[model samples]
Target: MAEPFSIKNKLTLMTEPAAAGHRMILSGISLRTGGTSRAPFASLNLGLHVGDDRENVVANRRKAAEEIGFSLERWVCAQQVHGTNIARVTGECAGAGATSPDTAVKNVDGLFTTEPDLLLALCFADCVPVYFYSKQPAAVGLMHCGWRGTVRLGAVRMVETMCRTLDLVPEDIYAVIGPAIAGADYEVDQTVIDEVSKLGRGIRNGAVTPHGDEHYLLDLQALNRAVLIRAGVPQEQIQVTGYKTSVFPELFYSYRKDHGRTGRMMGFIGMKNKGEGTS
Candidate 1:
């Protein structure tokens, strides 16, 4: 498993040699980080709707954007509804949801754009953060995939959107499965098991296993990878971090581990300015 380098205090960055110069990151929970939100939603919480102080969330977002060489004005995000809907971001949508939830691209879980300098971001605790980039078109994308989004095949939707809107083919696309709860720490009820089982044999193979009492452990990373492969993304073109949020409290926030009283890490991807170098 490849590790994201910590730029400062637990905030980390994930980059791939294959993606050329695209920037992708998975933030960590660290007190020294820049947000002013208080305990529980402490320090670096980038989520605006998670009961954190609005001012603090904004400050944290500004700091993250600056660190990545993106201005707050160019940061684009969405109101993640845990669905498969994907939005094609453009210059007009830049800065939406960067400071508040109301202005976000409504009810969407995935955001993609070919526009340079537009930073696409999404919040997550245990939900899988899937990233997409294409060298051919110089495009990038980010998706929030929880159990609902996974069963709905959010990755496939993002691929299809990129194909339709950006004329990108799945074979030319590169993807990364960022940190989330691992199978060992994630237990689901029979309802979730049934829904995931409907995804097909390729996805069901090692993705779900029986736990005591009508409950099962689900591997969201594996499930999303399978969906991407089925959508035409080659296996070698994808990267899985394998970093389980539940197992690393000091490094990340986990909704299930903290019983819903927790902050969220940010997953971001964007193309750099034409003359700018990778950070």
Candidate 2:
């Protein structure tokens, strides 16, 4: 693989390639360096629920849509309650969560669709942006998994749901574990570690490490990867970007690092219109 993601424009970190024909996975994770918001938000805030000015957030979203080549109207968003709830949407659900958070697919952290040209989006600061897709049926999914979502096996749920809905086996799914806080930066108390430990030693062995004083360093990417592997997604097919959002202040906003007052980046995944593209 030759770098699964790259900086495409001022607004997004491109992934998979957006010019590989109709079946290409057209998706991008917004960077915090552009747009109109100021100060705490100071630019590129794709989340409306955050305290940023609505107009500025909308403007930022438009910029992202334009750069990613996905129409703003065809986009579907979720309120992201940090749960494992995944919604399967279609053309009829177009524009569900575009400008307003209220209209976003109510309380879902994950969204998927086999229909083309419909983008599924969610916002993030430090949480994992788990992307899923399968070529045979032409589908894409985006999920928000924080420690809570990960402990609940959100990645496995998404894979299982996609497999069940598409009538395919887990091997058919291709997963991407996008940017998020790295283990060195994500220390959790015993409560969190205890839940994670329940995931079995194989999963916990690579993801959870004692941080001293009852705290533990948790590698969310590894945990999600382990669960996905358990769900039957081939280890080789799954890609972990190794991009840590918390470490890049100029390029990303970290809720934990920023002390809860910061802008959000959009994680968008969608299939482009026919002949309209991604790699």
Candidate 3:
């Protein structure tokens, strides 16, 4: 495997280093106080549609928004279906896709905006959260990359979409691969192993196991970074937060670690002028 990339966060919020002029904050609420009491849902569960208590999830999202200086009323998120569709944001369409006080967006995994006031966020649990930013064009984007999204090269596609639709150049973009299931803890079936191995760029020697039918540990973060590189984003421009969501249950939620019934964490990206900004 390549050298591991780590996501550096500021204060207690979960932020990624790869994205500049933006923040990738993650929530740290616990299950007992903030999460649903369902056995699988546990605590701090923010997914309202996942059978968690609606009131608690709403409260949690509001608290998170306040902490990050964004209005929950203005934040927009798509109903994620793991497809590669990327939506462009505008002032007239602000808060157009949010589902409820606890849910938003109907079927998009990628969100991009040059609109300064609209905050875009995606919910994650063991899925790789990717953040995007550009200095010259002055825009930011965020994406949720599960294994399906990564295998589909969603990270690379997001960069390309920005370049094609938003007039962003690859060299000016900074991509950060946020926390997810790392290679060591991410064991996959033979089919997945073979598919990733064919990618040729991310598969490391001994990353796969030959015993009992070829199970392998897939490195989603590294593979996603490879996709960004292939899309023309420089290696240094790609900041990786190799934090394992499964490893930090206290600070973030993990679907696999908590057995598919855990709370969610939010990864956000927004652009603000350096000297003159809105609070």
Candidate 4:
């Protein structure tokens, strides 16, 4: 989606000023971001909770972090529940909190933090992985959006969460809709089609596609983009990957592709001011 990460793609990795303090690395076994495991998990698997060997996942994360100049320990992960819950991360929440003994600060699908050097990660298979960064507020956020979360206005919720809590305007924020199940492959029943169809005309027209009789294919990315626009983000300010996760099995792990037995990939973001650590 983002210009098909080429052999020269590595040069464009750190081009975004918003990503200067942190690296947004997407894996490519060939030309796409595929997990490095094999068979059910293939290579590049980044999820530890999916029955993947914890040690292997850890090793994969280590390489990803090292490629970007961050400690594998500095990247943080969350326990997601497909809800619209958004957690505000602080300096105290650094590193993967999955195995943390503390339970007081658990649960959430989206996370935001202004802390420099505190990277944030969220695991995804087919769900739309959304990343938000504000050049104005110097804050970053990650969200996992599926059909359930999308219907709950998860992307809009993330935007509102940042705008209301961090004094950020929608225009000042830039968002990217990462690789996910495109409409052509995401067939849904009439009930679901109806539910999404009711979400105003943009979704009904721009994101929904017919699939023979009682089924329909939904474009979660376009729907999310529409939600962002309705929430006040300028069209140009938002970037959509539009990459179909299920299409490229080698580069990405798709629950649909593997019948729900696949490992997950981590989409993360972190930021610091220019004068702070060089991300």
Candidate 5:
């Protein structure tokens, strides 16, 4: 019920409210705002590997960067292998995956960077967008958490990596569990349920419920929240958005709802450079 993501311009951009004196721009862009891709991908499709036109994907990425007041060359991304691999990015890694998927940081689902003016991005449809920010160290990270990544404690890994790499404490880190398919809309097999249960009994209790034989409704957001808490992030410092991608097809691209033939929305976070303004 907590609407942590505030819609700024219909579906173009939704940002987290400024809190704890931290003003890093954390956004989950929608599928309706920009881009030149065709149907299924439609418009505003930032992902290049989703069968959308490569040229359109490039155009869309450039448009997104321009809208955020950064050049496409400053955007950094990953291949998102649905694993727990975390990549520590620096200014030297700028434009790694900006224009082409092959140039993306290989085999990583999470990206952490202290460098300013560089956007950390991950593509998602139903997978959760886990965001991390540390005020003292002035760093930001973006993570892609699908079912596989969630079971592997991707959020926990990201937080731990940030704390170790940035020399910050978990209590000072602010995390946001971004939009994804809600439990009511996400049904999983017994194997997934068992895997998630490995997190602990407490995490398995309300996080998943039996739907039918060998099926359960899984709450990935809740599971990720528990993971963050167990990883030492304070409950008060974490924000979970209520938007469900599958339930809101008009404003988001839903892999499940669209039968896996859909586009992807991007989760982006970065610290602005000196004298740069948020639009």
Candidate 6:
């Protein structure tokens, strides 16, 4: 397969740009670099709830937005409760959680829209960020899925909402599974395995592998791909990035690797509504 994502630079892995200019949609995940925060949650930490200084986090966000070509004023963030709940927002919902967590979309793990210039963003350390796009309707979606959100059918709901609410056709959609903790670095016990087993034999067989006594390695990206495939998206249309958070400490912040005190990387998807940026 080809590279799952591209970037204007090494700091942000962006989507394919418009052939000549910034007239098209933009989507990408921010690498854990180019920011102002201190260690542990060191530099480029975009999440507000991770105990980083508020000013530093906001400054980091401003830097990210400038680099990503999306204005913070038009960005909508989620509180991300790790549930399957998702919200579809428009331009008016911009900057909801750009600087603070309290104003973000409540309890939603996902966000999507057909609206232009309205960036939907969610933060991650080791959790999965799922991207969905339909060119026909010009729609894009983003979701935050960890173990809890995965088992709760977060991706499935995003697909359903697109088809039902946005009138998109499943076969016409493309999905990109972003970086997260790889199976080799993520070990789980019986309870987690049992929860995954409920997903069905096909996914369980490929996603869960025995690592040791009563322990299994869980592949979150693979699991989300399977879920999207089962939800009617074509398997071939989905692209999974090999970039693993736990494996690449230099490019990403790994929650498991850092032992619960790490920064976050933001995954964003949106179109530019004819603005002063994105050249």
Best by TM-score: 2
Candidate 5, residues 1-279, lDDT tens digits: the string is 366776766345566534323445555555555567789887788888899989998888877776666678888989989999999999888998889999999999999987777888889999999988887767888889999999999999998898887788889788888889978999999999889988899988959999989999999999999989988999998989888898877778889988989898888887774445753
- For residue 276, model 4's alpha carbon misses the true position, in angstroms, by 6.4
TM-score of 4: 0.85
Q: Residue-wise lDDT of candidate 4 within 114-202, one digit each (tens)?
A: 77677677778889888787755577788889998997899989889999988878887778877888678888889877778678876
Model 2 C-alpha lDDT per residue in residues 1-279, reported as the tens digit of each score:
445678877788978553323566777799998799998997888889889999899998888888887778888999788899999999999988898888899988999998988889899999999999888788899999999999999999999999899997999898888889988999899999889989898889999889789989998988998999998999898888857898888889999999999999989898865665532
What TM-score does structure 6 among the candidates reach? 0.95
Please, what's the RMSD in Å of model 1?
A: 2.8
Root-mean-square deviation of candidate 4 = 3.9
Report the C-alpha lDDT of model 1 over 162-184, residue by residue, as the tens digit. 88887778998878888889898
Worst ten-residue run, lDDT, model 4? 23-32
- TM per prediction: 0.91, 0.96, 0.83, 0.85, 0.94, 0.95
lDDT of 5: 0.83
Writing each residue's lDDT as its tens digit, candidate 6 over 64-126 gives 888887778888999888899888898789889998899998888899887777889999989
- The parts of candidate 1 lying over 4 Å away from their true place are 1-9, 16-34, 277-279
Better of 2 and 6 by lDDT: 2
Instruction: Give candidate 6 misplaced runs (Cα > 4 Å).
Output: 18-23, 273-279
TM-score of 2: 0.96
Model 2: lDDT equals 0.87
Q: Which scores greater on lDDT, model 3 or model 6?
A: 6
What residue pairs are clashing in model 2? 16-279, 17-278, 17-279, 18-277, 18-278, 19-278, 20-278, 38-42
Q: Rate the local accuracy (lDDT) of all candidates.
A: 0.79, 0.87, 0.67, 0.70, 0.83, 0.86
The TM-score of candidate 1 is 0.91
Better of 2 and 3 by TM-score: 2
Give stretches of model 4 more than 4 Å off. Answer: 1-15, 19-36, 98-105, 273-279
